[model samples]
Target: MLRKIAGIIFVAGEEGVTLNELAALLNLSPTEIKPMIEEVQQTLKDHPLSPIDLVQFGERFLYVTQADLDPLIKNFAQSPLQQKLSRPAIETLAIVAYRQPITRMTIDEIRGVSSQAMLQKLVSRDLIKEVGKLEAPGRPILYGVTDYFLNYFALSSLEDLPPIEDLALNSQTASEELFSLKRWEINLFDQEE
Candidate 1:
């Protein structure tokens, strides 16, 4: 029973499981759930080969991969032969990374196109995920970069990303230069001729 509870928590990921919620789900009391959680924590501590830990975040309990294995996981996630992000996917990732907790509609607004496919690709790649929903009218889903994003980029935190102001300035300069090109308006149909 304890192991089953622990497995449920492990599968919950960052969302976590509250004691009350677990108790209700398992048809047990809060008191009964507490000891089982402690036992699971102890088991995790005693098992050297186990790469997961039971952690408490506020009122919620989560099973997260041990932090010490981040480097190994990062390496595995970034192998060259593994899947790579396309230009649009990379751009979408950058937007989500910077303007985190943003809605898909906002992402589309910034990119000047529907980002549904790109967002789906990023989510499938585990670089971004649906964090929560906005409290507004439609209650749109909010997207955010995952810990894997930091690991893949070798960033200690989001603070380590280059300044947004610098990025904006560089982008503006690059766009101006691109627009100044004499052949910028070249017709695609000419190539087919």
Candidate 2:
């Protein structure tokens, strides 16, 4: 029962498990489980080699790093900062992420510049790829972001992409306005910092 309780607590991680919740799951009353939880806590406390401790916050019990190992644990668990993507690359990637299975010519038209170099760089980094060819005059290659792109951007999936404000991007005027607003927003953010 102690092992089962400890296993459930460990699996719960930071969210933790309440005594009442555990009792309900195990078909036992809270009173019956209190001693077992106390035993688990004492066993963990008595184990000199153990790097974990059982802690309670309000009615919840959870596993936490033992006090003495905080620095080592923090150092070992630190996540490195991701490399920053270039502005052009980000813009191209955003377009691909939002308007996937799109052609390079269409991308160039949207950005009002050639996207050949950016596309090549994105493909090389495995962030974007030539997914297929558009069935048109020359059968221009269609580009889309890969699963790697989602990972690189820390996105669960393409659906996680932020909604493009004012989706009426049928005209170049609307596109220009959107980019201008975005640049203005960036400036405002920089000023706030």
Clashing pairs in 1: none
Q: Considering summed lDDT, which 10 consecutive residues are worst modelled in model 2?
A: 183-192
Q: What is the C-alpha RMSD of each candidate to the true structure, in Å?
A: 19.5, 14.9
- TM-scores, all candidates, are 0.46, 0.44
Per-residue CA lDDT of candidate 2, range 110-189, in tens?
88889888888678666789889998999999999888667645689888754565544543654454344343122111
Candidate 2 matches the true fold with a TM-score of: 0.44
Model 2 regions more than 4 Å off = 79-193
Q: Distance from true position, residue 24, model 2, in Å?
A: 0.3
Error of 1 at 44 (Å): 53
Instruction: For model 1, state the Cα shift of residue 60 in Å.
Output: 63
